[model samples]
Target: MRILLVEDNTALADGLSALLRGSGYAVDVVCDGVSAEAVTATENFDLVILDLNLPDMGGLDVLKGMRARQSKAAVLILTARGATEDRVRGLDLGADDYMSKPFDVSELEARVRVLLRRQAGLRSSAVHYGKVSLDLNSRSFSADGTPIDLPARELGLLELLFLRAGKVVSKEAIMQSLAAFDDDLSANAIEQYVSRLRRRLAPYGLTVKTARGIGYYLDRPTEPA
Candidate 1:
């Protein structure tokens, strides 16, 4: 999943970025609200972690801007403002969830999972495609009831493909979903990941099909006519 984290504290942002990236999410960090607004306007994100105390603008105003732009990304308010009134205002302004400072890392991670899953309209912690199964909670993969280990990037690619199985996903969309703003990921790199994943999944009757000049899609093996 792709996430935009807006926070002014460098240390906190770095820590959270590492944590989320370790969890297989593509995270972009911005310290000010204006940058947040600009990024949201241009790029797509699955989630936004906004802090109310931005330098250029209040996080609430940023939230308003996001809604004004008709952004469908789920917003999670993570701020030092613990006032009930602030929370009410944020929710009334369309924040999906709110978390105060001094929060537990585990709880924050759990909330992130919940918000992302909710945004995707997924109810279960696991998703299945034919013989391939993905455990959302653990980020593990299994084929035909046997476990398989994959690199983090490959796993992220698989998740994106599985979520939109049967639909043609463009390379640009995959790059946006799998890479952060600062990530030096290129189209060639994406092709490499796809190739590796294709090889890994082919043994289990799964296929990652290419659309020639377009992108790729995930599917089961074709049946004989």
Candidate 2:
């Protein structure tokens, strides 16, 4: 999963970025609400870990701006403010979840998983399409109930494709989704990943379609019982 972390605390941001990256999440960090708003506007992220107490602008405005532009990315409020009113206000502003400062890293990671699962319409960590299945927790794929081993990047690629099943995903968007703050990926790299993913999924009636001069989309063929 790709995440946008908007926090002003340098230490906290660094720590959380490292932790999330270790967990296989591509994260981009911004120190203020202004950058948060701008990034959320243009970039496609699965989740946003936002701090309400920002330097240039309050995180509330950033959340509001995201909603104003009809962004569907899940927002998780992570700040020192833990009052009921703050929670209610953030929810009303379209936050998917909220966590207070000085929180447990494990709990934060759990909440992030829950929010991501919910956003992807996945009741649990497993996503099923035709005879193909993928377990997010295990980071494993299967075809016809047989285990299929995939590299970390390939697994991430398939996860994104599965979540957006029929929707067209641009190369630029795919690159951003799979890339970490430090990793430099080119368009050809994305094509290679897509090619490998397509081959892996083809036998199970899952196909990745390329739109001329556009992007790719996942297409699932009907499976006979």
Candidate 3:
């Protein structure tokens, strides 16, 4: 999942960035509310992590802007303000969840997972596609109810494809989704992943069709990969 993090605290931002990265999420950090507002308006993110105490603008203004723009992405407010009024204000402004500072990292991760699962239209953490089933909560997958082991990268690749079946996901999009945000993964890396995914799906009667310079589309053809 991709998340936009708007936090000015360098240490906290860095720590949270590293933590989310370790949890298999691509996160973009902006120190000020101005930049955060811009990204929230333009980028299609799965969620936003907003801090109320910003350097340039108030976090509430950012929330207002996002809600005004009718952004559908989930917003989680993380700030030092723990008052019931503050939390109520945030919720009234459309923040999906609120967490006080110095909170447990596991709680934050759980909230993030819940938001992602809701966005994915899954009642449970596990999502099934054809004979393959992906358990987002456990970070595992199985084919035909049997254990089909996949490396981390391979599992991410499959998750991206299965999450948006029949859609034409560009190479750039795939790279951003599968590669860690700070990782210097090249376009060739995407090609290698695609090839590997195709080979893996071959046994399941699926194919990742290269769209002749456009991108790739995974087709579960009635025939085969």
Best by TM-score: 1
Residue-wise C-alpha lDDT for candidate 1, range 1-225, written one tens digit per residue: 899999999999999999999998999999999899889999999999999999988899999999999999999999999999999999999999999998999999999998888887899879988877888887789986899889989999999888889989999999999889778999999999999998898777788999999999997654322
Residue range 1-225, candidate 3, lDDT tens digits: 678889999999999998887777778899998998887887777889999999888999999999999998899999999999999999999999999998999999899989888877778888776677788876677777787777667777777777777778887777766654466778788889888888877776667788878788767644444
Q: Cα lDDT for residue 178, model 1?
A: 88
Tens-place lDDT per residue, model 2, 109-224, is 88888888888887889888888887776567887779988787887888888889888888878888899667888889889988998887776788888976888989866653
lDDT of 3: 0.83
Ranking by TM-score: 1, 2, 3
Query: Order of candidates by lDDT, top first?
Result: 1, 2, 3
Error of 3 at 20 (Å): 1.2
Best-performing candidate as measured by lDDT: 1
TM-score per prediction, in order, is: 0.95, 0.87, 0.85
In model 1, the runs with Cα more than 4 Å from the true position are: 221-225
How well does candidate 3 score on lDDT at residue 73? Answer: 88
Superposition error at 47 for model 2 (Å):
0.8
TM-score winner between candidates 1 and 2 = 1
